[model samples]
Target chain A: MNGDDLFSGELENVMRWLSTAGIVFALISAGLIAFFLTRRPGWRMTPPAKWLLLVGFFLLPSTTMLLGNVVGFHRVKTSCAECHVMDPWISDLRDPKSTTLAAKHYQNRWINENPCYTCHTGYGLAGNLEAKWSGLRHVWHYYVAGVPEEIKMKRPLPVKTCLHCHAQAASYLKIEQHVDPEMEPQILSGELSCFECHASPHPRKNR
Target chain B: MSDPSPPEAKPAPAEPRRSILALTIACVLALVGLAVTVLHLAWPSPLMFTLFMVVGQGSFAAAMAVYLAVILVDLRRRKVL
Candidate 1:
């Protein structure tokens, strides 16, 4: 099913309109800023509407973010057949790298069985809007605070996010066999998350 | 040639009071913006939350640059270079 077919006419229209609006808003905002920079004289607006326009300026981006979240949530929840046909982007997860990364959900079994959301929920959930406290806070910790280089060479394991799912299958992993004898203390104490030995599910290029 | 002053031995630069004032105002705005943003991130404040809900996409850094650019142009016109 094409995306057009997957979504009802109204929903598809709204999605299209939203995506287009986001692009246009981004472009227009960038362009206006550029124009204001090059031209010394500022564009004058009527005093009464100026505040309203400023308010609107801020609202547009936030609205786009919300709309994007809604559409993205919908896209992921749809069936596999709908995914392959409607959104090829979702299907691209079948690629080897994505497959391998996703496989770490289980120790050895590499199967494309679970829908992406089954294990990974609560992302972008319009709540927990703190800097070090949001839903994405865990990711920031993993990338910036949690993983230490010294521990990585000494022992390989997954990060905290990995353990969120792997905790259930802890018995499957022969922990002692996988972890170095030296680092057993940390591993056994739950101090070291799994991503220590296993590579990060999502690795950044530049640290 | 009056010991042709070494290029590196130039007189110390003077601070522009006008520029300083503009910068002070800019810094205040930026701090307020950052505080609101941080609050919005942590525990959302209604006013700040509303502010962020709008204009969240426009880069604050870019806005700062624009604000500074305007001030710089004004300073130049005032022969403060």
Candidate 2:
């Protein structure tokens, strides 16, 4: 009963619906374009023909393409696991005995859904897009330079990623280390990492 | 009298080549979007995810631009601009 399971199941249904619509519209649109492409545009430039083109080319495909990303990208962890390099991290997440921050959060259900994306996306309204674009960069790197043998984090873990959830928590505020005025600004300003005090975010066994 | 007033082939349409080019490009872009969308849905990997999000949405936008251009040109020809 992982939260991701429930959310992912819902997204799966939506994705199926969207993909079906995308395929249908794409077929119709392409077929209609071909229809007009081969024949005389002047001869068939009727209002109905125009309507067909509008629906086929503009309306349907636009909706389908937009929704496709939503239903498709919403399930980031599932998508992340597709690459072989991610297998160990994903395995650690699922391992009951693993003590890494990611594993603890997963096992404890601290993150209700999209645990992978939520933790890694840093913080912003565009955080999702940032993460996705970063993923694209990863894809480019994987195909080009390949994952470094160590598969290290590309950037420092954003403090805001932790603050996004924990900053306002009563338990988080009550922590003795957090109350230290000298360290508070450093944490907020990204000078110090929470992991230094807490623990490393992930296991260091990447290969 | 050797073939007085000989026949001649009809002239082609005066419309520009880019009109057709735009239509063709739109179709191709749509097909690519469709293929990429399906691939993402099928696999849902980061590569496909990026493609669907970027290439897929981008294809639709570019296709719309070209298709809209074609429509605008037609409208202007009819003096509706």
* Best candidate (score: lDDT): 2
- Chain B TM-scores across candidates: 0.48, 0.73
DockQ of 2: 0.36
lDDT of 1 by residue, A82-154 (tens): 3122233343344444534543443344433444444344334432133213223333334456643321222
Return the TM-scores of chain A for each candidate in numbered order.
Answer: 0.33, 0.84
Cα lDDT of model 2 by residue, A1-207, tens digit: 566664565756666666676666666766776676676755445677678777767776776676676666676655677778889888888988888899899899999877887787856668877877788788888777678877777788889889988988999999977868998889888888898878667888862
Off by over 4 Å in 1: A1-18, A27-45, A49-52, A61-156, A159-162, A170-207, B1-60, B64-81
Question: lDDT tens digits, residues B18-72, model 1?
Answer: 4334433433444344334444443323323344444442335444664556456
Candidate 1: what lDDT?
0.42
Task: Quantify how close model 2 is to the true structure by its C-alpha RMSD in Å.
Answer: 6.3
Docking class of 2: acceptable
Docking class of 1: incorrect
